[model samples]
Target chain A: MNTESYLDSIRRGLRGAMESDERVYLIGEDLLDPYGGAFKVSKGLSTEFPKRVLTTPISESAITGLATGMAIRGLRPVVEIMFGDFLTLCTDQLVNSATKFPLMYRDKVRVPLVLRTPMGGGRGYGPTHSQSIEKMFLGVPGLTVVSPSLAHDPGTLLKRTILESERPVLWVEYKSLYPKQLLNGGDELRIWQVEGEDGYPLAVVENFSGSDPDVVVIAYGGASVPLFESMRRLIPEEIRVRGLLPSRLDTRTKTPWWFSEITGREPIIVAEHGTRGFTWGSEIAAELNLTFFGRLVAPVRRLADADNVVPAGRGLEREVLLNEEQLIKAIVESIT
Target chain B: MILIRYVEQSLLRLYAQGLMGGTVHTCIGQEGCAVGVVSAIDRQRDMLFSNHRGHGHYLAYCGDIHGLIAEIMGLPIGVCGGMGGSQHIQRENFYTNGIQGAGVPIAVGMGLAERFKGTGAVSLAFLGDGTFGEGAVYEAMNLAALWSAPTLFVVEHNGYAQSTPSSLQHAGDLSRRAEPFGIPVTRTEGADVIAVFEVANRLLGQIRAGKGPRLLFLDTHRFAPHSKGDDFRDREELERINRECDPIQRLAAQIGADTYEQVRKAAEIEVDIVLQELGVQ
Candidate 1:
């Protein structure tokens, strides 16, 4: 059997969802026609499922709004924004609208909208293209952020997110990893959990929460790899961090309660691969305070890309961001 | 006696005594437009979303004035558990918000939801002429037309937009703006409640029948200043215009003296009972 590529895995995810329900469709810029997509994860989909894959305008606002519209209208619209940086152009739709659209509608509307955006900055695209903004949306009230490593199956992650019915999800698949090999040197993980072979799994496995007796480390997108690596290196010795790869930087998850157990209202540690100011770490710390501020063990400290625009050169870019060393230091420093 | 004027009077009276708290913007002299379009709506099936100045829209839907009154007073007995106050009230058929143009896109979302669910529900968004300038409203209009969502855009053009009149603010005719978006447009006199309701009813039915997501403009007057707190008053001619075009009086006249008296007595009794209940609570 052919080993799974991230692109093929994502395609398998889309195909599974397409087979499972008629409501699932590919909607984004250049997602249709001879142009499958910027990353080509939606490749060959346009030819096979003409109506299922739709081409939208350059309006990220419109794309997300359309996704929100379609999602509530009972269609599972997987929207693609070419880069994670473009999300700033439509913060209202993503933040105030999509994030809260479910709650403002009193949970009467279930937004099964998935946004697929490629993150990381290696090709010298400069300020606009070089951002990793997953952390900026971490604390939004009703969204899920999933960034699975190469060890995790993209197809499974995508299916899980689409199958979920409660809130919208922002699935940030790494651009570099689009061609990476599968989890554990294996093919796609076959799930018999879905009731029917014909139907998609329950909203593409929105796997963000976990319960175990160890350290809770939150990571998104490509950062999951480094986070996992840091945990591996730190394990069998110093820090016993259990990596928690939340699908989105959202506030609704019960994982923060898990965080509360370790820190005891004392400052907790949040790590991000993007701008430090609007970090998801601060969001978790704030929530910790919001629920139980006075009794915290310590103040929350966050490790992020030091609030500067991501530079072009690899050396300069790496210098600015928190790598595994910095991540471990930040975590150890927080509750120490 | 004019429906809009009567509705405005009730809204203003509540505001005057500080009974209704969070920001109140009544379409006092501008009632005709809301009454005109909303009167044509089927309260049972059709849905309406309104701007901060939305009492007229809800009243036309036969909303409980006491619930509205208790709501404006910021009471828990109010519609949205005292959370929304004046701006955010979600009644059975109508939902109003205080956040300027925020309701426009939400209305579109709700409209799309209604359409997809095949609920046979036509969504109406009551925006001020001022909000027409908002991008969210235009985005909503574009999406509504693009998806053919069953929504009606009602711009209650009541002359002034909080000190700046519509003439200075809007460069083109409000109805014509929708033409570029492939949305059909209509204009009705706002002071004439029947005219507003008649046109609104037709458009609403067309929308329910999957023929429309049209925009309707009702140009009228605001006899009172923007709010009860506004020191500014309409000049003598403006004042005279409001008294002369009062809708309840006009509708009462058209329906005959006997019918008017019966409706008036019933409305008065209803109001009295509401006030009594409010007092008890």
Candidate 2:
């Protein structure tokens, strides 16, 4: 049985990219050997590839901008934003430079840097550290945003991004899923795979287990972990619901192709780690409504965190983030 | 430098005549910093990054005047396919960004890539005096010096960051700021192309020789206002700086007046031909 933790998988994927290509390197805060990154994702990587793994100063703007420069110079540089909240600092370079350059210059060059940041709130890291702000990057041209959950192998997805992706990739990992095993070994169901710019699969899991599904729950990243757990608790019978998990979230191409296969008036529920307003859930709902507007049984219900900054205390933090109870409530509300 | 002057002058004329679309930012008097530093550095191996006022930098390295004019004119044959205009120009190893000090850290990344590949190539970033306020520049300096990356930070200290003067912006000098990071700093006075070139050439030599990160603060001046229609500077002081430290005038003084006139005439003729080709008088 081949099993690996999500955190170890990300490290393996990084090592794979570096080992395979001399041009690929890692740059971020405390990513060097002894410290091995803030999350310990680069634990032993600096030891093996000392020169390739660089520990940079606390400059989020520089991290993104420098990686853009390296990418322009024909080097595959992956920058890790120590925390997801710090992405606000790097958005200047990420949005203005990394996203604009390739298309602005008519594809004369490509920025192939992967910005790997841990998102979502579970740990009591407070407002600055714990944030699921991937929604901010939605619809940003010339950039691809992907998140991994228990459904997809984080290592394989990361390797694909480094080795295969042409444009810039914003790879978001969650704090909760780092120590969990990927969802595998269940009854065979349809897998909706959307191929990215480089033909790498941006998977959307549609595990219905054969029976006619009454509702389809679409979720991603940290939200998917709780959604699946709630689904298992609610039902064991044949196809009362279908779980649709999409890992990629920008300028989507192939998701519409699979939309035609979902033939029913079954209510679609979009769950995410971001706050309720202006989220990836909104974008997904918009696209789904555009295609399946008439077929929808109800207005697409969205399950997400409260519209408030993530608090530091354990009890307050639990109250803000998405939980199993909320998922069950949204699912039941949509179907009824 | 002459071509840049003529092209930017034409752009201003077009803007006034309502011929161009957006407002323009020009580097009329600060041509020496762009031409000198870019000419002194390695275009084949090294990379160059610039700020908002970057027409001079583009023409200095790429020398594609026709492409630049087309870009400013929003023609389809522009350098960036009419997408980037003057502020965002991209060529082989040359890139210009509109943001203030965003290029510094990006330039650091290129320097790191050069070190990692053992290419012995240096990365040059052209920042304005206003960029001193940006914390990213210092962060980049720290990383570059800490890792000993071959990067050069060139500050075209044109006295003002937009409308704000250096004195009002900061308390002390620019060079002393980088001293705390252990990065070597060199300051050059005036906008003479020869003087700026000599200093940049020396600093670039050391950087390519693995001397880590270096900062060259070129004391230049922007003759024009910040952008197209923002005339808020002291006109008398602006005139004083221009008359005393005009880069082209300084160059003409070094070379003969006849030779300088001939160079300007040639650039004028080239600009005329490009304008004719684009059907714009």
Candidate 3:
């Protein structure tokens, strides 16, 4: 049986959303027929929905502002930013314009725009192309940031963001996860999905035997692949590990629903593909520290890339980025 | 033009009395651009986006004198429920924001949406001469022309961009800025309401007829300070502009003295009544 890749899932989701809603439009640079897109996630889409899928010039600011206007005027526009790094060009439109419209206009209008772009660093594309910069948009009031991983169906999350969300969403897609296969529950490891308050899905993976986990690792997006690998490898070593992979990273200050499932005494590791410092892991660690204060055996540890810029060399890039070995080591150290 | 003049003049008085807070960018001398261009568009179907100096545009499009007063006064009964103050106002198809050159791309998108939805409605965006410095405006124009979006760009050249003169802000002729984008450009003396209305009507007609985007440049002057008491121009220059480019005075000359007095008094009384009802006076 042919298994669907993460990229295939996202493309199918885009196609399904456009086919179902006449108001949904796929707009970006180089999204035309024959070229598809830079990452090919939009491959063959323009050919299928010739008029709805539009290729725009390399003007990120105008493209984002145009999409905001379209969303304001009752059309659902999904803008593809070529690469996640280019999102800096769209900051003004997203931060000042899109987020301000609803409240600034006193709830008279809604800007339902979805800006999807690929982020992450394992490919040695140099510093500019591979950084996970979604952290910059985490605290924006009206913007919803979500990064789907291999443990979940990115296509479904993207479709929901396009069709259901009334606020502007920054959908971060990891370049590394695009080629990976979707996780299907097996006997050795079982996977289950939980929905967030805003209807975003979170994938939970644990051993099929259902014994209480020795430790819990919370991660999302590109970090999930290594996390799953580490969990599987630790099974033979007799270490029980439960993983919480959330597609939606912006939970605000609220703790995850599965936070109560884990014993406060067990060490919790918040892993991400983004570089260290004020980041998604840092925020989660803060929340965990606040909620489970005095009850935990050890403080919440964060696993992420080094603070240095991602280098172009494969070996240098791997050294800076998180890998299965690093996660395994962290997990082993935390439990022992 | 008379209503906008009286409304802004009353706002200036209230602002001086310290009853209204924040800065009010009035279109006192440049009322012709607001009245002429706004009157030409289909208010029910067409979309309008205005910039920082947008009080006159808001009044012309909706004539909500009480709503405008209440909005600027920070009342819940205002058009934006006191949330937008003066720089931002929303009434039906009319929208305003304080940012310069940012509304152009939004207007293009709105124009494209109308065209795609088969509405046959044109989106009109208003900007000042100083807004030419913003790169987003050029980007929006390029996309609008390339995609054949039904958008009309209105440039209100009011001499100064909040104290900085246009000569210092722009290098070349502002009227021909849109030429490279292949958008047809037109220029008009903003003090003549009839001329502005005629040109705007023609350009908007072309846009609505699927002729893509057109640019209407208005050579205008603002009688009031950029916001409040920020004018640094020479006294003689200000007086000369006031005498030559006052839309209200020009319109009064067109009509007889008696008719002008009657219309002017009526507009004055209308503004007075609204201010009285709002209890701001």
Candidate 4:
């Protein structure tokens, strides 16, 4: 069977969007010719659409603000911040300017801008370069945060975000998942996707076909990699686990349809690659707790990396980050 | 300039009476830059971004006195439906924000967008001497020069950033700040609206003709306290500015007393009508 890498899928999605829409422009640093961006997600895009692909100076704040301006003036600008950690430099433009423009302009204008950046650690990129800091942008009012996992087609999600989303979006690509193959169901696993009302997709993975799930673990982005492994491992122990990986991460008001499909009696574990406390997992767990109040068999559990800077060494990084073992332990504990 | 003076004076009255909420930064002494630069731009196609002290800019751009008053009054009939209040106002091709140096890059982007669309429009952004402290402005200038974006960076050197004097906050001359970026810089005393208009017209003509980015530095001053009573300048110096650097006074001296009085009265009546319609005392 043929499989596509997550990185290639994202590139295909960007190329498709630029092909269809003339207004779609890519603005970033190191996005021209051979470099094709730091992660090579924008590989060959500059050559295909020369004028539309603009290689900018190392000015995140200005580029973000410039993208906002372009978006305001009826152009779709997709900014690639080489690393997700550099998003801090563009916070003023994203938070105070881009997110506030539509409402501040009394809905007379829309900032249809997309900011794509690679996040997360595993190859020992160390503290500054390898941090999953999507949690910092969680509750920003008008900004939509989406992280596509291996379970879902990364390119499709990116293309949809560029063509459809009228609001500003922060599309987080997991750096570690770049080389992973897109997940397709085999004989032992069932993989399917459910589309959200806003057009974001949620991929559901289950090991058993007919049996009811003992626990429903919800995660997104790179967290889904270990989640699928834990689900397959638990099959031997007769512990049926179903995993839900949504492309959209900011779920403050909108809950996924699968959240209602699962029985309240089954335990739900919220897993994330970032550190615990005041995070995506916390928000999801809080929402689930409120919705499944009194009906849930146990408290909503959160599985996440340790609340510390990711260490540089491979051994130490593995110990600090979330893995299949940690997820399996959390699921078993929640069910028991 | 007369209309701006009347509107700003009326806003101050309303602010003192506690009718206007939030804070107001009036360009009482810097109307020359607003009127001159705005008069030179094509408002229908070109875009202008203003800073916190933007009342004069807004009035000079579209002369929507009633909308400006209603906006400051926080009424639904305002330009931005009163959601923007005094600092944040968006009408057609004009926009303003309270943040100091945030608008520069955004304006540059608008200029680049216009260039890409072949719209023949130039983007003008206003900054203060204090805004030189912001790193984003330099980044924007670098990008604007590198990309050859048709953006005009207008610096209104009023000499103070809120309460801090420019001398204490900045080193070297403010006019030469854009020198390293290779963007051509023009300096003019902002008290003469005609002179400002001439200089701004020449620079904007170059920008519209696809000459990359140009910087126009206006040597101006603000007679009113920054954001209602934050003035820490020497009292005698302010009095000297009021007498010598007032744009309205200089224009009046040139236009003859009779013509100036007629224009002043016409502006006063217009402002009164707008204030009465908005139900502000």
Model 3 chain B weakest 10-residue run by lDDT? B223-232
What is every candidate's C-alpha DockQ against the true complex, given to 2 decimals? Answer: 0.17, 0.71, 0.73, 0.78
Please tell me which model should have the higher lDDT, number 2 or number 3.
3
Candidate 2 lDDT, A1-336, residue by residue in tens: 346778988888998989998888898999887889989999999899987887877888877888988888789989999998899999989998888888887446888889999998888999888989998998788888988777777787898789877678999999888888666645343444565444434455544555667777878788877877777756753336677666676646634444554554788888888789988788778878887768777888888899999999999999999998888777776666
- Among all windows of 10 consecutive residues in model 2 chain B, the one with the lowest summed lDDT is B187-196
The whole-model C-alpha lDDT of candidate 3 against the native structure comes to: 0.89
Interface RMSD of each: 3.8, 1.5, 1.1, 1.1
Best by DockQ: 4
* Cα lDDT tens digits for candidate 3, A83-167: 8999999999899888889877955698999999999888889999999889999989888899988878888778878998888
Where does model 2 exceed 4 Å of error? Answer: A186-208, A236-239, A253-257
Tens digits of per-residue lDDT, candidate 3, B1-281, equal: 89988888888888888887898988999999999999999998999999998889988998999999889888999889998999988888988888888889999999999889999999999999999999999999999999999999999998788889988889989999999999999999999999999999999888888889999999999888888785778999999998888888898889979999999889889998998899866
For model 4, state the Cα shift of residue B246 in Å. Answer: 0.3
For candidate 1, lDDT tens digit of each residue in B66-108? 7766776767776655656666666565666565665666666
TM-score of each: 0.79, 0.95, 0.97, 0.98
What CAPRI class is candidate 4? medium
Task: Give lDDT: candidate 1, residue B23.
Answer: 69
Q: Per-residue lDDT for A157-181 in model 1, tens only?
A: 6887787655778888777567766
All-Cα superposition RMSD per candidate: 6.1, 2.3, 1.6, 1.2
Best by lDDT: 4
